[model samples]
Target: MELKVDVLLTSPQERAYHTAKDIAKLQSLNGTAPMLRNCEGLRSRSLGDWEGRLAAEVRGTPSPPDAEPLGDLMQRGSLGQLLPSCYAAQLLPVPLMVEENAVWNGYYRE
Candidate 1:
């Protein structure tokens, strides 16, 4: 199956940007590459005080008081200003989940 990209929207984070760039490059291999645009709303949710803590330490704890709510983050992705009109876009910050899980299973194993 071929995926068609009109515009490649990405988070400003290094990892996300790089992954998007690589995709853009692959698209170029076949035809004109899609334009890459950084979308702030695509960035990972801020975990507040849990930002840099080990995964095991934060796994079962309550969300931090200052953390951004998941609903708010979802709303941001749908905001008119953040996304172009009549375009296909789905914001999934899988990296956020992967990072913690990878840390738990790889680095902070019990």
Candidate 2:
């Protein structure tokens, strides 16, 4: 009987960067080599004002109606009303999952 091993591959951004570095090092050991292929179509979204802040801190304040959520701010076209260069490019995680207080109760007078 013969034994075989199967391997799975993951193309995470960090993994790709390290792999490229290792390849460069190995090539240098031998001699000058051609440039490694750069990872194309790889984009990282900016954290904006909520970068270093904790979730608990942000949720402590009441969200205003005009206040855009972290997700909308991170998106591209969402900011076009204020900036001309704004455009949607990638997806970003929501910063605040829960709000401390509801912005509107939607109650109407009879």
Candidate 3:
């Protein structure tokens, strides 16, 4: 079956943005490709002082002073305010998906 998309939401990071851009090229909504919207909420967590360090080196160490907390990450990633409005507007998903759509990647709900 042909795929459809109403909206393509992605993290502002280069990788996610490019991936979504590629997917947007292959899908269409109302005969037009959807635009890639950069959602800061979808961004990878900020690691602060630990950002450039190797995982092996930082694995068991205490969190850096500026590291984002897991709870904060979850809250931001949830996109609670954004989701309901998008759902109400009947937006489909790329990464953050709606339940009825079968193309879940990292789609968040609630």
TM-score of each: 0.66, 0.24, 0.72
lDDT of 2 by residue, 53-72 (tens): 78787776665454555566
How much lDDT does each candidate structure score? Answer: 0.60, 0.33, 0.64
On TM-score, the stronger of 2 and 3 is 3
RMSD of each: 10.8, 17.3, 5.5
Residue-level error in angstroms, candidate 3, position 21: 0.6
Model 1: per-residue Cα lDDT over 1-110, one tens digit each: 77656466677677877777887799799998777767676677889999999999999899999999988876765535345322335442221211111211011111
In terms of TM-score, the best-performing candidate is 3
Please tell me which model should have the higher TM-score, number 1 or number 2.
1
Please name the candidate that would achieve the greatest lDDT relative to the true structure. 3
> Candidates 1 and 3: which is better by lDDT?
3
Cα distance off (Å), candidate 3, residue 59: 1.6
Error of 1 at 22 (Å): 0.5
* lDDT by residue for model 3 (24-81), tens: 7767533778766666666778899999899999999999989999888778666574
Model 3 regions lying over 4 Å from their true place: 28-30, 79-110
Candidate 2's C-alpha runs over 4 A off are 1-12, 41-110
Ranking by TM-score: 3, 1, 2
